[model samples]
Target chain A: MAPKKLGLKQRYAHMTRGLDWETTYQPMDAVFPYDTFEGIKIKDWSAWEDPFRLTMDSYWKFQAEKERKLYAVLDAFAQNNGQTGVSDGRYINVVKLFLTGVSPLEYQAHRGFAFTGRHLRGAGPRIACQMQSLDELRHLQTQIHTISHYNKFFDGIGEFPHMHDRVWYLSVPKSFFDDARAAGPFEFMIAIGFAFEYLLTNLLFVPFMSGAAYNGDMSTVTFGFSAQSDESRHMTLGIEVIKFLLEQHPDNLPIVQKWVDKWFWRGFRVLGLVAMMMDYMLPKKVMSWKEAWEIYFTEAGGSLFQDLERYGLKVPKYADVATEAAEHISHQNWAVFYQYSHAAAFHTWMPDKEHLDWLSEKYPNTFDKYYRPRWEMWAEMEKEGKRFYNPSLPQLCQVCQIPMAYTEPGDPTKIAFRCTEVAGETYHFCSDGCKDIFDAEPEKYIQSWLPVHQIFQGNCGGATVPDVLNWYRMNVGADNMDYVGSPDDRLWSEWHAAKTREAV
Target chain B: MSVTAIVPDYARRIEPRDPVENFHGNMLVYVHWEDHLSFCSAVAFPLPPAIPFGAFVSEVVAPAYAAHPEAASIDWSAVVWMIDGATKVPDMEASLAANGMKHKTLVRFWTPGLSGWKGTAS
Candidate 1:
């Protein structure tokens, strides 16, 4: 007779719990050294629950099927000359930014999860992290493969790995993951799994995917959908870890709460890049960044915190500040990028009439009153063959590494600045949130590799524009600055002109 | 305390202290109180020479805090000026220029014993 097959739940239990054994030669603490250092009290490892009930066999099967489907779409996208199908060449900058900034983060997440998976004391979270590790790695690979098609037709796509490490703007995402990676296992989980993946991932991923769909980049949309299916599982793991730690001991609540506050603001600051991309970069806009923030964060996230209320957890410390910032952050960041696009790897442009009208509609309270006039000034300059680019580098905040561009909370008219003097030397922060993070761990942040500081110190390429661009491995005229007279722009116009001739 | 008198002198003192040698110009010197959590905002102004630290606090930081909704309760006289790490600049009569402060130099106004504020420094 054939061996009896296990049922689904039994199979999950056998695959997950059965993998663990009592270690006689080495104690559990010696074996798993990372889990307890974060001060999280876990009384029983068995109390951990993998909500997906996922096993290695099922995990591999599902991911493999998803990969096959994603690759098929990517192939068709390439075969059909999908680059030409995009709404406009300007849209490619969104892909370029995604490739250079966000994809490398996926690889970093993979490494972070793999380390945590191996070291976490609980078999439940370990398996979940391990599976999520593979998922992150898959996301990185699929994104690179999908966007590499654009690299052939685009300028800024080359040297992404190097750029992610060294570029000024890319530092936002790089430093964020590095901060999480340096934390204790539990803190790392809370930072990425909960604060980033569960609470804020939709705001980052959904808009980009929908923007991809709107811009006719089907490959990105396909890969995005494929990765999002796994994101649901990652989200479950995020909430589970938070609940597990909270249930373990009452002392764990405050620690978890602080991490929630710190990581939420950190993640929100990083998404300022995404917010600008959604509101400005897409030729055909999907949804306003403010609208997405209200739906995904204010509404959905508010409910999530409400669910956790019984566990004695409150919303993050600066939730209201972030809610208010959503209305203004995209406008503020895009303006900074517009002025300093010369130093960046990606292109920036003034939004056309239709785009400006949409922004005015979406941000009626502040757009016309505060932001529209600046764009109008730039647009006026462009009309006379003059584009304004700030020749000097702006001051960078110590913690977030962004240019000091944010305004005071509840007051968009004044630039908000926060500073703390520690041990004699003063550090500047973009907001109270960043200032608080630095004050808590000054030693960690004082070592930030700020690009502007690095350049001034003669660490980046050299002192001049040519030297720095070469050092950043950027193509200068081809890869960066205003999109109006760019090679991509010229190519776009010529392609359309040829199409018009063909139709005649 | 004339605005024009302070402007040119502050520019002269602060412009040369930029850590980046290539960066030369008037830059903002940001000061904040360490003990008062409500006093987190950096009161930025051009650096001026020969201004007493006490006057700087009373005139600059105090008014800024007074404007803030939550910071009205902070005691201005009790705060100490901290600069360059652990060094305490005890002479409030000394000018910022005499004490060697520069543009973007962070001066933290700290109180010795403030209850309810979480102190991270050991």
Candidate 2:
């Protein structure tokens, strides 16, 4: 039977509980105001078209289903010897980073989405934003829940909340959120909605999901992809938000232009970790960071730039810097990851031969020349049962909180450095400008959320890896013992054994 | 919050060549709105003759575009749709290209009084 097509009011009622109180009786009294600012007149706001065919019923049902599926997986993983299934205790570093760096962004998205839900004008849009808000809230919860499973087994997860509050390394994401939260509603849409969602979302989620898949982490991939489905809707919201504002006011152009320029660079800097994870961390590499950026940013961005130029706005400054960063970010960040693993919750295993082969294929220019040799040295150490761990703390960037993986533009080897004095003690930074920024505001600088500092202060996990792992809820696996009898391995063996017995 | 590539096994390199002789630059622009009374961001990409802006936008951009708008107008067939960037879209280039839209003659304008400028007139 063909589905009955109801009128807009009836359909809306079927979708939502019912139309607003006055829909049937009250006469339309210009309840919704049109855009009057800047003197751009729209004779018809009704001309607007909603691309997403979302209704309340479908929204709730799909969301509920997604939750059911996710929890089932989580339950299985935990119940069937999931506790000991890991690559190594070293791999917890990735989760540590995920909890501290990535998970907090989930919370930020939740907050931002809530703001969008409340502020959006039309009912249809309000619904979309509300769905997105719920989606982001779920994402935050699931990411915490899934990774929390590891808190019992790893070190760095315990430090995330405290680190997010006070770690210098965490300030990268924190400041990014702070910038968004401080902006006007429209500006927030541009900064995060358009700039981050449209321009940068692919960079953030792709590598993390692929890394999860490659490392046999089913939960992260499921949750990441599940959340991303909603992100597609959010991306549309971003795109529409920009168009709607521009169409509404001719005066908004320059303000919008500056926002694009500023946010593009800001979001790009924060995504440096993503750049590394894309190019370096995944065991089964799909695309290089440079390639993803070029395809996602350049081909797509170049077209958008031309379109905007027709409208009259400059392509963002530091765009060239972003393109350049993509080229070397993988090698640089992995090096930092290798050095910092001693302090991190995750393990850092030397790149296996298969991983090296993938690197050679992905990074045709630099991997073999510079990073490959370094990995080879680590491989040799691994051969002798030694894992290389950098003894000293890395110089962290003041702005991004990441250890400065940057060198002079084009000089990959020259590490950047800066320093400042606060409370009669010299503080160090990745660049002189950062040092200057710190010196100009020592109070803000001193209040930084540095994970390493907290670790030493005995505020996290009672001064031991196990204690910290418990706090973080991490679980080390069979891979930790060279892939022999960890949960994954045991489960594999058990499943196979059962199958073999059935065969008999 | 999270971005997943829905397309299957899609991968390519972003190779930037040094300035080459006889390079004819073409551009693609896409303007999309996220929600009602929210904001519209434009994405622009500079393409050589090699890339077909229309196909990319229809196949890749439209789905993403539809996802964002409370009410979105999707013109997969309209390759060179001119968006008045000054008035309707801001930072119009990157957002368009991010969604796979493009144009031939790219101009950036910001004032509402400016006549014949597709964006806001200055």
Kindly list the per-residue Cα lDDT of model 2 for residues A1-504, writing each as its tens digit. 998889866676457434433344543333332222213333333334453557767788988888898889988887864644544333444565778887887788778767755554455555656776777778889898888887765444655665565543466788777756644455677888889888788777776777777666777777886687788888888777667656655676776776787678778777877776666555455577888888878888888778767567677877886686676666766666565453443444456778788778777776675567666655665567665554323334544556644655565444444444443344545544345445543544444444444444455575564554344444444212222334433555665587589889
Q: For residues A66-94, what per-residue lDDT tens digits would candidate 1 score against the true structure?
A: 99999999999899988888999999999
DockQ of 1: 0.04
Point out where model 2 deviates above 4 Å: A1-10, A13-58, A72-96, A119-127, A145-168, A376-392, A416-504, B1-122
lDDT comparing candidate 1 with the true structure? 0.80
Instruction: Report the TM-score of candidate 1, chain B only.
Output: 0.57
lDDT of 2: 0.56
User: Each candidate's lDDT (Cα)?
Assistant: 0.80, 0.56
User: For model 2, how does the per-residue alpha-carbon lDDT over B25-56 read when each residue is reduced to its tens digit?
Assistant: 53322222211101111222234434444454
TM-scores of the candidates are 0.83, 0.60
| DockQ scores for all predicted structures | 0.04, 0.01
Q: How close to the true structure is residue B44 of candidate 2, measured as C-alpha lDDT?
A: 26
